[model samples]
Target: MTTTQSSISSTSPTPTVPSGSGRVANIVLDSFTEAGRHVRIIPRNIEVLIFATIQPVMFVLLFSFVFGGSIQVPGYPDYDQYLMPGIFAQTVVFGSVFTSVGLAEDLSKGLIDRLRSLPIVQSSVLIGRTLSDLVRNIITFIAMLAVAFVLGFRFEGSLTSAAAATALLLLFSYGLSWVQALIGLSVGSVEAANSAGFLWMFPMTFVSSAFIDTRNLQYAWLRTVADVNPFTQVTNAARALYNGTDPGDAVMWSLVWSIGLVVVFAAIATRKFKTSSE
Candidate 1:
């Protein structure tokens, strides 16, 4: 019994995370490994992936076909160009919901417990999840771009500017994924996460410049809200880049907002994750 007690004490503690440079290396490697695990299995779950891509495509078609005829904004003769960037922003922002739902699902399946049992950085699991979801968002974005081109959407900007716009959207979405991570860790079930995660999405997206110019909004308060929304900064910046127009403060503000969201929410989510694991 004494020998057994001594042996147990001599063994490393559960989830024996490393220290100093070793810990940093472990986090980087473990995060990529977890991301790979999620990404690799994506092929087997083709239907979920297909539907996720399809929703944005449908939105593009519906807005371009039904609403394109009547919606006219000053300076934009073809509404498709003005419309495409908003759709891209809205879709990717909505895509962050996947991170929350996925995490909640993993928790329900005891995957979180399994991850905790291993000698890896606990926070790496969250990082990996957000990274994998970002991958899926990239795939979805590419598909939407192809469809947008078919709908006569043209980027008047240089290819480099267009690429910059795409990067900005992805960066914003990546930041939102961290916010979802916190929600997922806080929620008890996948259903709860889904419900809670999307509750703010519609207001956040539609109230902004996603569909039309916030300048056209008649209500001053509503316009103010849309103008101040972080999503508005992202959408406006993307729109300006795609149209080869100056983004003014929008681009800088978008980067600032995205980076801020990532920094703030990643810290909160990491703390919540550690607490939940304990």
Candidate 2:
């Protein structure tokens, strides 16, 4: 019995996972799994749902009922139809900001360091943050859909197309989260990270083809910019899914953007994290 107690007491504490090959995959999976377990503990889940649902719902009604009749798209039947998909893309895409803010908060509170010491997978920090946010965004998407239905926005596409649209949106959101995660790691300050994450969305969402068609713009340059914006691709993809319009090249563009962001930002964020650790 004494020898057994000594053996138990001699056991070493778990070591923090070391960064190396396949570290990222392990980190991301672990973080994602841990985040999933704590979903109910996060107040942000409710906040995200409310924000995602209410804002889009209001925009849908405001545009469709108030101004929809006044504005018309040449190839579209009505304004609400054009506006609904845009709102989905705009609202969900903006969710990337939360990824950074959450990471910043974790770092600021030293929760990241604690996790780092827990024998976790090396890339777990970045992966966890990205995957967790992806799950949250999915919830937000569902809530937004509920709101959309209540406001009379209907999907005209096959269920398969709609499911494909959701998958694409989630993929794009995950890729964007990697960039946001890097921003959080670099800033290492919750307030600054939050501001940086959100500030870009203003120009990205408002100045594009989200609410108004580019053709209606008085400025040729503004029209040109909106026409080429990556965001327009996402909205167009969503529109295709909603109205049964052929996804065309917009889906391709969306996929390119998502994959590109993941590669670029994951590399940057991982580098920053390693540098910070060293």
Candidate 3:
């Protein structure tokens, strides 16, 4: 056991601080190294990769065909136009869950203990994990986009607007990846992380304007909840951009919310990662 632990601990080389002058560069380098390691493992674990790609595609098909015609959302008679962005928002949000599950799995396998013994930047492990998940999300997004286009979902907005919308959604999901980082570190096992990470998102996504416009919601309280929901801002912003509609302040508010979540959750999760132990 001692020898095995030593081998795992040696996976990363000692990082030099040099009175912290090179700390930022060190973090970038180390984080990239860790990210590459995680991404490379994806192919070896092909089953998980397949499921990750399949889920969002399945969602697009189901919502675009099944629930789409029955539900009438004003200003979106085509339905696919409005629904695609919401589904994109939801897909990226769900993609962030991999962070928690990945971190928890590493912890259970004693990888965290091994990383703690290394001299790398303390935050590199989490950053690298999240970055790798972002790459996965990008791939999933591309796959979903192809399917959406086939279903008559055109980018009604200019190319620039479409790109900006995609970037905003990715940024939002990346921010939530930090939140999941804390969840993964706080939980006892991968199963706990998986359950805890996903339990709240149903209400988070469903209660918002992701599926239906806030105006169409029958209940006042539900509409209020949807209005206050940050996810609503994100979905609306992306939806407006994709549809080439005047977003007003939705884009700005979404950017602020996304950046805020990233800054706040990254700090909290990094702090937790430092003191966490089995």
Candidate 4:
């Protein structure tokens, strides 16, 4: 018996893994695995992201080339400079519908719930979706930037300012993406998500100081609302960042609003993520 025990112990394989304290390590690994899956699946559906770019380009070309020749912005001799930033904001803002539709589809298909059942971090699913949306936004933004450059849009800011502007624009996009994700989770179908996302654009972008300056808005209430609109704030910040027009409150306000939006929508998304039967 003693000889047998010694031989068994000697022949035993060396322990390959250290004893973990608990399931935390497994959970984290699973979380990242799930996130990777989400990313992979999203980009595969290139059709959805391709759709996000169509409207942005249409608006840019129609407004910039057509109306831009006639309409002029004060202080900025070239209309392109004044229009480009607002155009970027408009494009990014409206592009958020993809997130809504994607989320709604995932929920309706029981994909999100299946993910939840896995031994992974709860927030991983949302994080993955948000990250995937960010990737789509980056692609769309790059496409728009390239088109704008071809159309003679130029930036007056230093390289640092350009970088900051890009980051800020993406942050705003991310925040809006989260909000849309929440909307998607609540909606009945992807079609509803798509329509509802665009429904807000008329009021949010048109009513704001997008196409015209707040000072020129004749209606007192509309002017006030435009001046205070977060879309306006984001556009102004992008304008300032692009034109190198001194760092000011617009940038600060834009950041504040973006952060606030992410916080609020993220909370709601998390709850829905936890409770979703889908």
Candidate 5:
């Protein structure tokens, strides 16, 4: 009995995490590690990459060729150039649904439970997933850009301005990822999460200046909504920047909208993550 007691006592106690900076560092490190895991999984799930690439490519092709001739932009020489930026913006925004479906799958498979069993931070899983999705979005952007190039879409602006526009789109997509993360955590299944994720995006993208000029919308309310829609702001900003037109206040508003979304949705997602974990 004494030997048994000694043996039990001698066994190492469960490690205790240090408070303050150390804890924060651990969370950051764990987030990167989780992000790496997600990146690695992409190769095995090639269908995700394929499906993500196909829709945007098709959009770029169909809109540039079939619809380009009929679409009239008052100042643009070629409608294809004007259409590409909106297509890119729409693609990134739609890409965010991948985050929702991925998170829902993880939750359904009890991956969250398994991760929770470890010493990692609770929010790291969501952060990592979003980060990975951002990387994936970058890939999708490249593919779409290639397709756009083939369809006669050329950047009229300096390379620096073009890069800035790309960055803004990615930032906006990252913000939307957090919103999708919240949806994923809230929904019971992947299918439900996918549906819930795109339910708002359809209206959000269609009602904006993505395909048609906001001023052309027949409905007064739609024009008003499109004027204020963040997606419209981003799309318009991207179009101006890429086409070398004066962006006016569109860039500023796009930045504000993206930052606002990140702030709002990140908080909501973090809270939902904690609740779901418990």
Candidate 6:
């Protein structure tokens, strides 16, 4: 019996993993798992799905029919074409509020605490939340585009240019999601996060070239501010690309702004998350 026990012990196999590689794998797996949880929730909430689909559709219709006649672009015959990119930018930017509200709700409900207690990677929650929000924004973008198409919005640019424009808008929204995540982590409640999320966006969008040409503004100061606004750069880039016009330096500036936002906000959010966990 002693010989048998010794033989069994000696033959036992031990598992080994490279710590760095293992951690990376865990983070990837955990993030995707968390993202799947959020994605599943969308289908279960019928009202949320309905509202998400309807709101952008409403925006496209209302803006195209009600305001199209009155609003004029210097070189365009169809205002709908001019209007679609603005609506696209607006809708996607507003979609980031969901991230803030969602994270705030999770924090308030003690879900963050629960997650902290788990063995998963610490950054997975933020990564997953941002990714899920990006997916939601994509859906919203598609719905809005379809509605815009029915309203006579067409892409005058090559399909590749239109696709690139869409990608830029999504990248901008992704960066904004990180910003919202930081806001969500900072705020005490979902209500505060919701209010805070839209507060900045209103001024930014209105003051930019999203709805109109910056040159058309009555005040020189307003035009100057709009000209320098990051939102203005993004909208102008999208408009130029969609209309097959020379995108010029707008695209480069928009890319830089988006990348900068992602880096700064992501670092802040990750630090806050670690602090909260402790």
For each predicted model, how many residue pairs clash, with residues at least 3 apart or on different chains? 0, 5, 0, 0, 0, 0
User: Where does model 2 exceed 4 Å of error?
Assistant: 1-29, 37-40, 43-48
lDDT tens readout by residue for model 4, 24-68: 766456556655775676567778667767778788888877878
Q: List candidate 1 stretches off by more than 4 Å.
A: 1-21
Q: Give lDDT: candidate 6, residue 106.
A: 95
> Each prediction's TM-score against the native?
0.92, 0.86, 0.91, 0.85, 0.92, 0.90
Q: Which of 1 and 2 is the better model by lDDT?
A: 1
Global CA lDDT of candidate 2, please?
Answer: 0.78
Model 6, range 6-44, lDDT digits (tens) per residue? 565465776554254687898998899888888878768
lDDT of 5 at 115: 91
Query: What lDDT is obtained when candidate 5 is compared to the true structure?
Result: 0.90
Whole-model lDDT per candidate: 0.92, 0.78, 0.90, 0.79, 0.90, 0.88
State the weakest 10-residue window (summed lDDT) of model 5.
Answer: 1-10
Better of 1 and 3 by TM-score: 1
Q: Compared to the true structure, candidate 2 yields what TM-score? A: 0.86
What TM-score would candidate 5 get against the native? 0.92
Off by over 4 Å in 6: 1-20
lDDT of 3 by residue, 1-278 (tens): 34554565455777564344588988998899899999988789888877887888898888888988888898888888988899899999999999999999999998888987887888999999999999989988998899899889998989899999999999999999999999999999999999999988899999998888788889999999999898999999889989999888999989999999899999999988876653
Instruction: Return the candidate ranking by lDDT, descending.
Output: 1, 5, 3, 6, 4, 2
lDDT, candidate 1, 10-114, per-residue tens: 666666445547778889999999999999988789998899889999999899899999988887898888889999999999899999999999999999999
